[model samples]
Target: MNKEILRLPLYTLIAGFILGIINLITIRILIRGTNEWTLEMGKTVFYIELILSIIAFVFIGILLRQKYNRTDFFKSATLLVIYSAVVFILEQIMQYWGFYSMINSYLYLPVSIFTVITSLVARISNLEHIKWLHVIPSIFAPYLFLLFSKNPSENTAK
Candidate 1:
């Protein structure tokens, strides 16, 4: 059996864990001015998922570049999109498993958007050609982040 398949999840999990810590620090910074830490804490799971997807996009790009020894923007972008979807689905499964607070229903779109931005950055920094269509996903990322940071489900009945 090829042992390489076993390393994939390990890579994904390490990527996820690092991004989770970054997400926690981000949450801390965002909530520093507010009085409701407990409320905000419940949203950490969503942020962790979002941040993990973003980082995973870049990580995947790096891996592809190293493997091919060239920048293939379209290929990397497509893979990033697919990978983001998989991660989002897995997060939903974990939430259903009661591993974290319920994922905010509105979470998926924003994370997908941010994943595009991060992937683009990774490509551009490595001198990949700019594809205008690829820019679409990042256009609303800032606003989406603001929306996502608010914990939309916190006050509602699921």
Candidate 2:
């Protein structure tokens, strides 16, 4: 396999992860109080991030279609899923170590959407037999975080 096939997706994953952390920080900074307007602003920022992530995923999906075949698509998807899992594990460790806080459950929704969109695009464009088994990880990545992360109410009670 061409090294670019592996490198491109890894680079995109790292960039997306950094941008997600930045987005989380920005949202935290923007919502200074419990006011309605600040909450609305935070939601707006979240939606914007979600849209931008979808756009990036779509572009990458098309690029993969143009440059690679079904096998390559599988390789890329596997790499993405593995990298996402590693990142999630690291985030959990950071939270445990008190170096990071658990993100809102809503924040992970975009990641699940991105993964699904990428897989669908690859399946449709490459005409590949994408097994449901292969897609399970993509579907559950966000929900895994949601399940494991501390609830906001639980946090406040402490």
Candidate 3:
């Protein structure tokens, strides 16, 4: 990884929000054919997912850049795992406290993908291109969950 990737937290955050909006646009386009989405819920999920995604993007970008091809890859990976675990725990805690909630299944998929991709970027040191085989979970899991949610059984029938 380049030394500069480690230096600019501000750029990362701004660029991350840019990616958040890109994610929002992608999600909007994705949910376009679904009758299941209400405007308010779409807005809410966009903001939530965007914020969470950007957070993961920035942290993972920074951490990966710093650790890529260094001797500390395992240590970096372990930290990523711990970070994801904490996010998962905090999300559950928030639900328990009624701070906010999603269906339990909604909670895990994104976080798991986040960790997997974080590990990928850590090892590969490339952003413009990803190794799809390694990062496919991030590429597909959220949309798959969205698709599965549209299944009739999710809403009504078996």
Worst window of 10 by summed lDDT in candidate 1: 142-151
* TM-score for each candidate, following the candidate numbering: 0.35, 0.50, 0.35
Clashes of each: 0, 0, 0
What TM-score does prediction 2 earn? 0.50
Candidates 1 and 3 compared: the better one by lDDT is: 1
lDDT winner, 2 or 3: 2
Q: Candidate 2, residue 136: CA error in Å? A: 8.0
RMSD of each candidate relative to the true structure: 17.0, 16.9, 17.9
lDDT, candidate 1, equals 0.48
lDDT (tens digit, per residue) of candidate 3 on 58-99: 565455443243323333333434444655567558767987
**Per-model CA lDDT versus the true structure:** 0.48, 0.54, 0.46
TM-score of 3: 0.35
Task: Residues 1-158, candidate 2: write the lDDT tens digits.
Answer: 67755744654565467557766777776766744456567557756666766565555565554455555555555665665665556656776788875562323333444554445544556656654355455644322222223345655565
Off by over 4 Å in 2: 10-37, 101-158
Scanning candidate 3 in windows of ten residues, the lowest lDDT window is 141-150
